[model samples]
Target: MQFTFALFAAAALLTPVYSNEITPMSRRETGIKLESCTTSQQAVVEAAVQRAASLAKAAADAAINGDASIFEDGKVTYNCGNGTTQSDCGGNGVLAYALSGNNKIVNCPSWYKIVPAIDDCGGTDQGLAMVHELSHMNEVYSPPTQDFAYKYNDLVQLPTEQAVLNADTYNLYAGAIDLGCQVGESKGVVLPDWMVTEIMNNNSK
Candidate 1:
């Protein structure tokens, strides 16, 4: 049985959204109200918009066969200043974006991105990056049991306890990561232990 399961796992690794492209002023519809202001304010809005865009893409990509092109028109709108809009940043703070599914993805501070470069493409398991990120998306939309628990319990502090929620989801995430690493290895790409550690860490949490 163990050998058969391993063979099945090896096979799955090989395997691989309807969004409005032409919704006019969809920004307002989506509650994104952009405002023109100082350099800093504009920068915040732009950053928020971009973050939202990435989140939207990731969510859509998870549903598809990892194809990002499906979410071409899923733009992120920003609420400038004044805080009148739901997407507006507070007092020149970074902007916020909400998905059609009512999911929120925030833009980080400017200084943070500059310091280490968010998504700098570090560590090995480059192919796993997409899989890992997609796991995050799965957490959002079709959250497995553990992920669902993570929402209630602070996963950052007590990562290990999350295993109590549901073992199945945890296994799914782990399997996905392992498959990613295997796929990379098959293509002659070597992944560092650190990258593998990160995947394990995410699951434990």
Candidate 2:
């Protein structure tokens, strides 16, 4: 009996034990890495990333699932600093940006807002900004086009094909889901019928 017990103990000791620490679903699925951020900044980023993931998942559960699938969730490193002497963030009122085909997201100094619980449709916040950058990742869309509009007003007027390819369209769709409001109701801008239908379908679900 003692030999049997010793054998069991030896076997248990030799078994490999795995860690219980589980990575967040958002970080795991999106491959988002936060670098060189303060504690508060990290908190803001975490919230925004979580919100963006939630928005993406919600969109995936609707008729616009194809749009949500475009995110790709590729590896992206986010930094809280002015990009290379403020080249992208200097004077154009840009909040955050990712260079075409780049795996990095640089947040301009002005991009310090926390993810807001949007109360109205057509409103933008940090989470939407993250969504925009995710769309710009090369893994998500190659040869990212900069000609498409990012502003809500202009986005509503873009052709359906062009709008689908624009980063801001994802932002707006995600934003609308976050707010639980329809884009047309808030801005009085008539989006393409397909977009309106998709938004309504998402909201209804």
Candidate 3:
């Protein structure tokens, strides 16, 4: 249940963002790269990487392309599509899971580029989408699909699964809060009520 949404989801919210602080990711090697996109979009991605530094670094090390000793081993590449229908960004972001490895790509869709969309509970659609996909790049949960991020969804909390679920919940809410707060400041849009509620609920916990 990876909830998919367009750029419109990262909505404007001036609320208190984080209630539950995210434990910092134990950083890893920067084995990831970005292959396509304009210089401007590339800059946007650089900013995104800086904002999500730990997750980005984790994504890098999680890839073991060929032999561990090889320089190009386990390298993951992301291409910023032009937010078109026929894009690798696959409606904001795409996570590919394979027998060999997993790949994540995000389309850098600007706030203005998105058509006027009605926000429901998804003010941080693009931001959350990006975070969700990047989080999956770590492969800690080993969910069958690359898209199954446990956000507002149930995960069976068996003893073996409880720890993973707890971690997932933290990351999901932390990113949600981050994206929610940034939306209003950067995107200049009003946060949907649902988004505010969601943020408040998470913060309360």
Candidate 4:
């Protein structure tokens, strides 16, 4: 049993997270507010938003050039059943999204909705997913396009403990780092400063 558990742990360490994620999407109508969502959901989203807000300013400052209204027009939505929203993105691994047509700063969308995984609601999973999706929103100004795992190999493990920061996409390092920071701040699951910096600065956008 000991050997078996050790083998599993080692395998888990090597395997990069491919999917089972969350993201934000756009909404036209009044949807689930942060207050209305489950407790776990709220905790996760709030933490993500807090950290994202912090990063928004610092990140923009880092570039020495960015938009002012980034992460300002954000909202929340709850997705259940198999087919929800445009991507149906409702599953165990492919959990959520912060949907946008393209990775452009100027043509930003009006309403960035932080969609939720309802089935995962009412528990720790909800909070985790909320943070995951918010990290997706961190890309509101500049949606990622490069696969983050290629750049930051431990991306799947470093950032958060609640949910896996799906590193399957071509780009998501920023969101993952945001997720990690939020998780650490809110849940006391902090990572090393160097790792956090590497995740944020390497493949942000």
Q: lDDT by residue for model 4 over 1-205, one digit each (tens)? A: 0001111111121112111232332122112233334455445544434333333323233322233333222233333222233344443344445443421111011112333222211122332333334334323312222223322334434444211333231123223333444324554334335434544553363
Q: Please give the TM-score that candidate 4 achieves against the real structure.
A: 0.33
- Which numbered prediction scores highest in lDDT against the true structure? 2
How does candidate 3 fare on TM-score? 0.40
Write down the lDDT of every candidate, Cα atoms only.
0.30, 0.57, 0.35, 0.30
Candidate 2 per-residue lDDT, tens place, 1-205, comes to: 0001111111111111111332355444545667778777777777777666555554444433333223333356778663334455756567787864557888876567433556556667887777777667665445443448967788878877687667777667666655555544754444556766766655475
Q: Please, what are the lDDT tens digits per residue for candidate 3 over residues 25-81?
A: 211233346655678766655444444433222222221111122223224455665
Q: Summing lDDT over every window of 10 consecutive residues in candidate 3, give the lowest-scoring window.
A: 7-16
Name the candidate, 2 or 4, with the larger lDDT value: 2
| Leading candidate by TM-score | 2
Q: For candidate 1, what is the TM-score?
A: 0.28
**Worst 10-residue lDDT window, candidate 2:** 1-10
By lDDT, rank the candidates, best first: 2, 3, 4, 1
lDDT of model 2 at position 46: 75
TM-score of each: 0.28, 0.71, 0.40, 0.33
lDDT of 1 by residue, 11-106 (tens): 111121224442222333333344434566555444433333333332223322223321222232232333334334343432222232332233
